[model samples]
Target: VSFGSELSNRAPTFDMDLSDFMDGDKPISYEKAKEYFSQDPSQKWAAYVAGTVLVLMTELGVQFTDSMSILVSSSVPEGKGVSSSASVEVATMSAIAAVYGLNIAPRDLAILCQKVENHIVGAPCGVMDQMTSACGEANKLLAMVCQPAEVKELVSIPTHIRFWGLDSGIRHSVGGTDYGSVRVGTYMGRKLIKCAASDLISQSFPSTPTQSCDASEEYEKYGVDLLKSEASLQYLCNLPPHRSALPY
Candidate 1:
């Protein structure tokens, strides 16, 4: 698919044009967006860039399978710490699964969504957001203990619930410097943790320490939380100047 935008001198204007993939070649150009509309300029530009691929992917699946649920209640709400990006991703994956008539269990769908973030959007995110969004059972907290990738159980928290955020009225360019830095920080933390785990196990033996904790236990006990904290701090340190970033 190819998308382009033309800015008008007097009014807000943008347009999208698309085409099909040839049998043996790539169909889309992964270039960045440069055009702008006057009134809703900045966010519009971001939305155009972000939502173009989102919409294209959503519609293609819906069209192929004639399923309206592919696009059902699917939108990324901005300025909220509630992970609109993950929501959009799960929506896309859910749509694709539905359209293709795939038998996808909830937990498996969550994993698939994580893969999309890791591979498609090039985000080094944890399974938490996508997992919860896709496989969330109402009135419960999903205990996603990270190592062998299993949803252990859900704890109930019954109360009148509310969600809110203090959005600083600041908009961020997600694919810009900050996003890349966060990704790099996350990668670094992951590498460090993996190395630490290996060293720890090697120390247990005369030649090398054998793993006492099962991989699952190590993942749940030390791996996930350690990496998350380290990555968040590293990301904060790496954020760009003049950019106000927040964490969830």
Candidate 2:
């Protein structure tokens, strides 16, 4: 029930091949997909799972009755940790909600979308990506409150700061090895913080309807503990920088 553009980048020489899953055992390399119709096994597996979930949700009337649905366009790239996958998922959820004439709150909708991508799709993404994409205001950077779907205006970008994107000659698959592990690490970091400074997340993210047990001042009172909780952040940050996963 989802609609989108062709998966492959079109060229005069040949039509790019597209895979329909993520097969961890024997992933279909990009080279193979580009050269032959045989799909990227890993991506094919993911797509199959995503497609199945979307169908079931749509059937259950989530899209038809939710106000959070709104139509939007996005060009987030996949893999490399740039959050394009979450972007598309949220965008599609927004679209379906729009089609159904639902009126759900934006923040709530963002949380739901994140859950679908992480839990339902079998990925271990953080709430930040989906929340940022959903709450993003054009020309501004969202300083994400990782837990409880809270975000604050970090700063606004120059209106004239035109962003240019460069695609690397190589593209990595979202379901490629280690990608999920990175996401899982980030999630664990948030949970670690949540276990102690629960209030920090609650006050910042009231729209989520969850209360934190610790306040920001209380969290700062135990600054060393906060630092220790975030120690695992390095793993998430150490991923190779690539075009597809850039924050911009």
Candidate 3:
């Protein structure tokens, strides 16, 4: 497999031997790719996207029977919170989909590419970058609700405001230990808060007086208020400022 930038005039940046990864029509997998390409970060990413494509094909019940080469190229800088990896995955996914004549919807492609990063790449990242790289129009800023890549619209860049990315010399890798640790910690907090809220909400808010105090215990709920017209504990965004325990 060869990875190159379509925008660049130079040769492909990375050439990898994928014979071992895709041996004779055998389906690729997350574990195989992870262990095989662990030593090379670049190759790892390449393998992940290819593996993801295979996984998707299997899920769709496509009887694919041949090993194929993939090309993923991008000019975006890596490890700086840019969509570098995502751009490559989008390009590769698009190419492979085209080759297979699979008419994958753009939004579905974006979401699946996100899985390539989050699950296959072992990077706990949102799908904003994939959505941007997949759905962005020329000279237009993609506006999306990135819970899992919901594209609302695309807005043109205003002449008055220019988006710039200057190198700070500090590098970032989404799959790195620091990034993973932070994500895990944040999600841990969410879990703790959700558990606490489940106990806080009383489903029987306005119940008739119980015949006995023992029956009152049953009426005094200690869990999610599912009976409410709207549940409020699932998402942090639904919580109001005054009522929320955590600061924004």
Candidate 4:
């Protein structure tokens, strides 16, 4: 819930103290944090915080000249496939940004959280969980797209309907589940589409003639065009179940 930083003589260090989970606080040096990430069996979820910090420092060029301490107090159940990890990533980034007096926009913050989950945590997740956690409005359902992540709309919830959540007591981790396989299957399907619809892709993109296009480049260009074209999107969505199953 709290993150504090102070100047340090050695490399930047990080310590996380979980109030109710772990026995007590554990301090991780910068080198140790890096080592933890590289080890065969990575540091598990604990590496997420360190990874986020490293990404902020390396990718966003946030210069932190101090060691930091993170304290988390939470009752949320983990491994429930309910985005507890995404929430933690967002909170950690927000707290770190606050301590450094950095102002991060909500959408951008969500993207950063996704980066932490995807690149740092090896979760291959989209931005929905992070975006919803970061920008959710009371009594509203947020609509967003992952490719070009943006809040499209916030539909007001109907007053007549009540939303309720039930805990099934079954725990799951995205990295440890079929989530990655599904994502891979989706991309594989897209690649198959690119192959089958090569002529269409070429015709749609006249300027970039398919004759001279590398297969990989063609796939990338087709993906970009597919996401940008409403007609193409609709066609894909309206595909017959049989045709749709072909890619998988």
Q: Which stretches of candidate 2 lie over 4 Å from their true place?
A: 1-74, 183-248
Q: Pick the candidate with the highest lDDT.
A: 4
Per-model TM-score on C-alpha atoms: 0.50, 0.49, 0.70, 0.66
Candidate 4's clash total is 1
Q: Cα RMSD to native, each candidate? A: 10.4, 12.9, 8.6, 10.9
Q: Can you write out model 2's per-residue Cα lDDT over 1-248, one digit (the tens) per residue?
A: 22233454421121211222123433333233222322443333233224323433433334222222122244555444577766776666666556666665667767666555543454555577778768888777888676556776668898778877677756664445576666645655555555445445444544533433333464666655464454233333223234224322
Assess the local accuracy of residue 201 in candidate 4 as a C-alpha lDDT between 0 and 100: 59
**lDDT agreement with native, every candidate:** 0.47, 0.49, 0.60, 0.62
The candidates, ranked best first by TM-score, are 3, 4, 1, 2
Q: Write the per-residue lDDT of candidate 1 for residues 92-175, one digit (tens) a residue.
A: 666656656766777676666655454334344566777778777777888876444578888887687754556675655344
Supply the global lDDT for candidate 1.
0.47
Q: Compose the digit string of candidate 4's lDDT tens values, residues 1-248.
A: 22221221212333443221112233233344444554644235465665677667645767665667776544555667777788888878889999899899989988887766665566767788899888888899999886677899999999998987787877677766577767666755665554545544565676644432234444455465563351244222212244345523
Better of 2 and 3 by TM-score: 3
Instruction: Return whichever of 3 and 4 wins on TM-score.
Output: 3
Cα lDDT, model 2, residue 112: 69
**Superposed model 4: Cα runs more than 4 Å off:** 1-35, 38-43, 200-248
